[model samples]
Target chain A: MNALSLRNLRKIYNNGFEALKGIDLDVEAGDFFALLGPNGAGKSTAIGIISSLVNESSGSVSIFGHDLRRERAKAKSCIGLVPQEVNFNQFDTVKSILLNQAGYYGLSRKLALQRTEYCLKQMDLWDKRDTVSRRLSGGMKRRVMIARALVHAPKLLILDEPTAGVDIEIRRSMWQMMQEVNQQGTTIILTTHYLEEAESLCRNIAIINHGKIVENSDMASLLARLHVEHFVLDLARPIAAAPVLEGCQIERVTDKTLSVAVPKEHSLNKLFSQLTAQNIEVTSLKNKTNRLEQLFMDLIDSNPIGSKATGNK
Target chain B: MNYSIAFRTIVTKEIFRFIRIWPQTLLPPAITTALYFLIFGKLIGDRIGTISGASYMDYIVPGIILMSVISHSYANVVSSFYSTKFQRNIEELLVAPIPNWVILGGYVSGGIIRGLLVGIVVTLISLLFTDITVNNIAIALSIAVLTATVFSLAGFINAILAESFDDISIIPNFVLTPLSYLGGVFYSVNMLPSIWQNISMGNPILYMINAFRYGLIGVTDVDIQMTFIITGGFIITLTLFSLYLLHKGIGIKN
Candidate 1:
C-alpha cells in the first residue's frame, strides 16, 4: 500500500495567494522519495497539509489508507514530519522534547521514556539530553528535531529541508541516519533544494514549480533522460587553443583544463580517440555538474515563467 | 487515540515551563498580591471602615482573590501560547494526532492550575491582614475555576489575534487591568450612583468577583443565582468559540 497519497490538493491563502494549485502525489511504502522545488513552489504548503498543520482548500489525503480528514488520528499517527525550520521549545531540555512528542502520539509513559532514550542515543544526543535546547549548536538542535520526530516510530517520515543550515559533516551524518531509518522499512519523503543530496539519497523524485509537478520519475530513469552532460578534464599538456572534435563541444577553461559537453548518444571513447589523434593526453576527468543538477537546471530553464514565480518571490 | 496521555503530556509540559521559571511566573504574582493587600486592604480599609457589616478588608478579600485568579489565568495562557507561536513551536501540537478539544483543554487546564496556585498564595497572604471565613468552600473553589477558565479563553483569543509581543500586551494593559481594577475589587459598586452601578454591572469581572465574594462573605452586590448563570454561560460560549478557532487553523496555521 502507498504510505501517503494526495489527490487534487489545493490551498489558497486568505490574501488570495494560491500557495498550491493542485498537487497529486503518492509515495509507496518503504520508498525514499524526494520532493524537489524552488522556494515558494508549494512544497512546504503540501507538507503542511499532509501533517495537518494547514487547512486545505479542497482535496483529499490518505496515509496507509486512512483518510486525513475523516480518520485524522490514524492518518497523523502514521506520519512524522521534521519541518524546514526548528520548531521546538528552546527552553525545553532535549529529553523532555522527545518525551513530550512521544506522549503526543499516545505512547504510554514507560514507552515514551524508552523511545526517548533510544532516539536520543541514535541521534548522538544522549550526552546532551539534559541540556536546554537553545544552548545546543545548530546541528545538535537539528538532530534533536529528528530524534523527536522518530520518537513515536512512525511508519512514514517527512523531512523538509532538514539539513539546510547544517555543515557538510553534519549533513552527511544526518543523511546516514536517515538512510538507516529508511532501511528499517519506514517510508521516507524528503524535500530539499540540494539536487546532489536528492540524487544520492532518494530513489524517486518529483520536482514542483509554481505549485505544479513538473517532473516525477525514478532517479535512474530521470538521470538517464539527461541527454547532454558537461565534463571538466585536466590535460597532461597545456594547449594554446580549444580542441576540435566532430559532434562534440570543447572549450579551453585554462591552459591545463578543458571543458567538454558530450551528448548521451555519443561515446567518451570517440572523444578520447579524436583527442589522442591530436596528441593530447587526459590526466583526470570529472563531471562539471551531476546528472540530477543538470536536469533540474534544464527543466527550470525550459519553464522560465513557472520558475520565475518561485524565484522572484 | 489515547486522549488522556495527550492531555496529560501537554499539561505536564506547561506546568514544567512555569516551574522552570518560577521566579518569573509564580513569584511576581505573589509579590503583586501582597502589595494590593498592603495598600488597598490594610491602609485603605482602615480609613473606609465597615462595608456590608464586615471590615472593608474582609469584604474586598474575595474580589482581590478573584482578581489574582483572573490576571494569572489570562497571563499564563496568553504569554505561553503566544511565545509558542512566536518561536514556531506550536507546530508540535498542530502536527500531533491529538484532538483539538484535547489541545484546548490541556492549555486551559494549565491556566486554571496557575490561577488557582496564585489565588491560594494570595489568599494565604490576605490572612496576615484580615480574618477570613468561607461560607461555602465548594462554591468558592468552583467560582475560582470558572473565573479562571473564562479568562483563559479570553486570553487565548487575544493570543490568536496578536501579531507581535506588543499586540499581546495591548489588551491586557489597556483593557484587562482597567476592567479588573474597576470591577469592584476595592469598592462595592453599590456605593456609586444608581446610573453608575448599572453601568458597572456590564463589566463581566464584576459578576465574577461578586459571585466569588458571595461564596466567601455570604453577601454580594449582584444576585448570586444570576452571577452563576452569567459565569457559566460565558464559560460554555468561550469554550466552543476557542475550539472553533483552533479547528479552523486560525493564526497557528500557514
Candidate 2:
C-alpha cells in the first residue's frame, strides 16, 4: 500500500485565496520523496491539509488505505509531521516534549519513555533533555522538533524544511539520522528549498508551483532529462583567455579555472581530448548546478499561473 | 489511537505546567484569597454583623470558596489554552488522532483540578478565621464541582475567541471580576432594595454562589430549585457549545 495518497486536494482560505488549487500526490511505502516548491506555492498548505492542520475545501486524503475523513484517527496515527515553524511549548523540557508527543499517539508510558530516549539519543539531544526548549539554540531546537516528530514512530514521516535554519554540521547529522530512519522502512517525505539536499537524499521528487504539480518522477528520470550541464574545471595551468575548443562551450572563469557547458549528446571524451589538444590539463571538474535545480528553474519559468500540468508520471 | 493515554497526557502536561510555575499559578490566588478573607470577612464583617441567620463571617465562607473556584477555574483554562494558541502548541493536540471531546475534556479537567485544589486551600485557610458549619456537605461539594466545570467551559470559549494575550484577560477583567463581586459574594441581594434585588437575580453567578451558600449554611436568598436549574442549564449549554466549536474547528483551524 502507498504510505500516503492525496486526490484532488484543494484549499481555499476564508480570504478567498486559493492556496492549493488542486493537488494529487502518492508516496509509496519506504520511498524518500521530496516535494519542492517556491515560496507561497502551496507546499506548506498541502502539508497542512495532509496533517489535518488545515481544513481542505475538497478532495480526499488517505494514509495506508485509511481515508482521512472517515478514519481520521487511524489515518493520523500513520503519519508524523515536522512543520516548518518551531511550534512546541517553549517552557516545556526537551524530554517532556517527546514524551507528550508519544502520548498523543496513545503510546503507553513505558513505550513512550523508551521511544523518547531513543529519539533523543538519535537527535543528539539526550544530554540536554532536561533543558527547556526555548533555551536551546536554533539548530538544537530544530533537532528537538525532529525528535518529537519521530517519537511516535509513525509509518509516514513528513518534514517541511527540516534543515532550513540548521547549520551545516547539524544539517548533516540530521540527514544521517533521517537516512537511518528511512533505511528502517519508514516512508519519508521532505519538502525543502535546498535543491542539493533533495537531490542527495530523495529517490523521487514532485515539484509544485501555483498550486499544481508541474513535475513528478524518479530522481534518475528527472535528472536524465537535462540536455546540458555546466561544469567548473580547475586547470593544471593558467589559461590567459577563453579556450577556443571545438564543440565545447567554454568561458574563462579565472586564470586557473574554466567554466564549460557540455551537452549530454556529446561525451566528455571529446571535450577532454579537445582541451588536451589545446595544451590545457584539468585537475578537477564538477557540475555548477544539480540537474534537479536546473529543471526546477526551467519548469517554473516556462509554466505560467494558469497552464497545463506537466509531469513524467 | 489510545484515547485514554492521549487524554491523560494532556491533563498531565497541563498539571505539570501550573505546578512547575507554582509561584505564578497557585500562590498568587491563595494569597489573594487570604487577603479577601482578612479584609472583607474580618475587618468588614465585624461592622456588618449578621444578615442571614448565620454569623456574617460564616455566611460569606461558601461564597468566598466558590469565588476562588470560579476565578481559578476560569483563569486556568483561559490562560493555558490561550498560551497554547499563542505558542502554537495547540496544533500538537489538533493534529493528533484524539477525538475532540478528549481534547476538550483534557483541558477542562486541568482547570477543574487547579480550581478545586485552590478552593481546598482557601477552605483550609478560611477555617483559621471562622468556625464554619456544613448543612449538606455533598451538595456543597457538588455545587463547587459544578461551578468549576461551568466556569472552566466558559474560559475555554473565551480562549478560543481570544486573538491575543490581552484578549484573554479582557473577559476576566472587564466582565468576570465585576460580576463575581456583584454576585452576592460579600453582601446578600436581600440587603438591596427590592428593585435592585430583582436585577441581581439576573446574575447567573449569584445563583451559583447562593446555591453553594445554601449547601453550606442551609440558607439561600433565591429559590434553591431555580438555582440548581440555572447552573445545570448553563453547564449543559456551555458544554454543547464548546463541543460544536471543537468539531467545527472554529478559531483553531485555518
Docking class of 2: high
lDDT of each: 0.89, 0.90
Fraction of real interface contacts that model 1 preserves: 0.95
Which numbered prediction scores highest in DockQ against the true structure?
A: 2
List model 2 lDDT by residue over B1-254, tens digit each.
Answer: 56999999999998998899889877887788788888888998888888777778888888888988999999999999989988899889888898999988999999999999988888998888987778889878888998899999999999998888899889899988888889998888989999989988899999889988998898888887787788899989999999999888888888
Span of 10 residues, lowest total lDDT, candidate 1 chain B: B218-227
Span of 10 residues, lowest total lDDT, candidate 2 chain B: B25-34
Docking class of 1: high
How high is the DockQ of candidate 1? 0.87
Q: Name model 2 segments beyond 4 Å from true.
A: none
Q: Model 1, stretches more than 4 Å misplaced?
A: A304-313
Tell me the number of clashing residue pairs for each predicted model.
0, 0
Residue B154, candidate 1: C-alpha displacement in angstroms: 1.0
As for candidate 2, its clashing pairs are: none
TM-score of 1: 0.96
